[model samples]
Target chain A: MIAELLFAVFFGLLLLGIHRKVIARIQRRPGPPVWQEILHMLKFSFKTTWIPKTASAALFVGVVLVAIGIWSAALFVVISGGSLLVIFAIYMLHKIVEHGFGLSSGSPYGKFGGVRSVISAASEIPLLVSVAAIAIFTHSLLISDIVSYQEVHGPLLITIPLAAIAMYVVLISKMPFGPFSIVESKELVSGYKTEHFGVWRAGLEVCNGLKTYVLLLTFILVFIGSLPFWLTLLTMLILVITLSFVCALSPMLSPYDSVTVQTLLAGLMLVYVGVLGVMS
Target chain B: MKKKNALALTLVAAGSGVAAMALSMASILPGWAYAAVLVLAFPLFVLGLGLYWMAREGEEDIPFLGY
Candidate 1:
């Protein structure tokens, strides 16, 4: 478990670094070094951290801690081969963390981000529907069991391509770019994270890195089947690189448009799952 | 100054935390020790970073400037 956590943090940071590099290359501009994120984190540790005078101090700090804790627990679940149901639940709880971060701050931008997070919660239904489809096909909800089933029956991607596509959309939306990033849209000046700086912001960065690892790992386990640890990490890195290119090439969508697209994807996924459930 | 000392301490703590994590992952330590280090690593990193940030001199009145 310790090893898994360390791997997630170390490689997760590297993943973000690679993402930045990829985006920079796509834009034909010289980007920060691949180790830029690590340097950023180190520099942040030496900077000043302070609570906003106008904000709710307890909630502001609490949200950061909660974000870290949630991602840590999710990492543990993935590493320990825990139930998919619990993983899905943690994914939903993440919305609460996002909402709390925004609402705790007094800034109107933060409030807007919080409301957008609420709207984005609609994306969760598609994620849940994807999980349901996997459970039905695998005849189990435990991640280890699902992996074992995949080993015997081949990868789930071949069996249910629609669910894979739906999961991929969910994963891309969680990233910082593309049409789904309205919560932290640039117009809101970084949105919920506008006021977070120094160490608190550092904490958020670590949390995000871990969140990315957990979500990508989950996708691999369910769709690609289990592999050795190194292979799993390599596959995830490749996926992150691919997603970064997609992000760099796409434009940001309006908040309403993002919600509409995500909700429609979720609805389609749910209907597909319903059809499959009946057939099976 | 006091702030410099705090920042130094923060650096030591954060560096140690990262080292412990790496050592544990490499499996150089006993199981119990590895578990203990794992538990301490993240909190140590966060606390050290937060303290270093908080102990800086002067106030940040400008946007997007300062430490």
Candidate 2:
């Protein structure tokens, strides 16, 4: 437990550093310094807190903290042999709360962000279904148990290639990289975060990094079970590089297109997995 | 003059503390020892800050993340 907790935090920070570098490279700009995230957090800690005139102060604070807290808990649960149903429920609750907070802000961009968030949630359902299908195949949702199954039954990847694909689709949609970068759309003038500033902006940025680390960790566990730590780390690096390249090369697309492609691909994967389950 | 050095040292100490805590949590050390070391980690982190402060004559404009 101690090890897992420490590993989680360490990886989280390392990921923050890596993300800054990745984004910098992608934009062909010297992005924020590698340690910028930590420095920014320190700077934000000392800054004056600001509340928007049109927003609910209490709700705004709650929204920011809730997003951080929920995300933290979800990531923690991902490590412990927790129930999958519970994990899924918590993940959903986090999204719903995020949307509610956006709507509560009463800003036009917040409203737009809320709507975009809802659409993304709608698109994520098929991916969740794939999780359920995989759970059924292994007859367990505890990560440890699932990994053990792999030792005995073989890696889940070979059997559930389609589900693996589904997971990738879900990951991209959640991270919403490349073409699906609409949530962070500059044209929306920062979208949900337009009204947020100072420490609040800092919190959101950390949360963004946290979400990336947590989700990537999830992908690693699901797709590649217990390996040597170095190997796991290396695999993660490679995968992120590939995603970064894809993001750079691909043209940004409309949210509509994002939702469509993600849902269609995920749906296809789910069906294939379903058929595989029936056959085996 | 001393106060400024102390403040920078404190900030560095905090940064290192976070890093050490993270290491203790993630490392594959025996669980009980890991927990005990993590507790000790905080003070050692502070000591580190004190050392950094003593070494500095007086400096502001601390480098980002170097601490």
> Per-prediction RMSD in angstroms?
4.4, 8.7
DockQ, cand. 2: 0.04
In candidate 2, what are the lDDT values of residues A159-227, reduced to their tens digit?
677677676756665553466766657666666676665556555655555566667766777666777
The Cα RMSD across the true interface for model 2 is 13.1
Chain A vs native chain A, TM-score per candidate = 0.97, 0.86
Q: Docking category for candidate 1?
A: incorrect
Query: What DockQ results for candidate 1?
Result: 0.21
Weakest 10 consecutive residues of candidate 2 chain B by summed lDDT: B58-67
Give the runs in model 1 whose Cα sits over 4 Å from its true position: B1-45, B52-67
For residues A215-279, write the lDDT of model 1, one tens digit per residue.
Answer: 99999998998999889989998999999998999998899988888888888998999999999
DockQ-based CAPRI category assigned to the predicted complex of candidate 2 = incorrect
CA lDDT, every model vs. true structure: 0.79, 0.61
Write the residue-wise lDDT of candidate 2 on B1-67 in tens digits: 2446646655664555456556656774443444444334333332333333332332222111111
- Report residue A132 deviation for candidate 1 (angstroms): 0.3
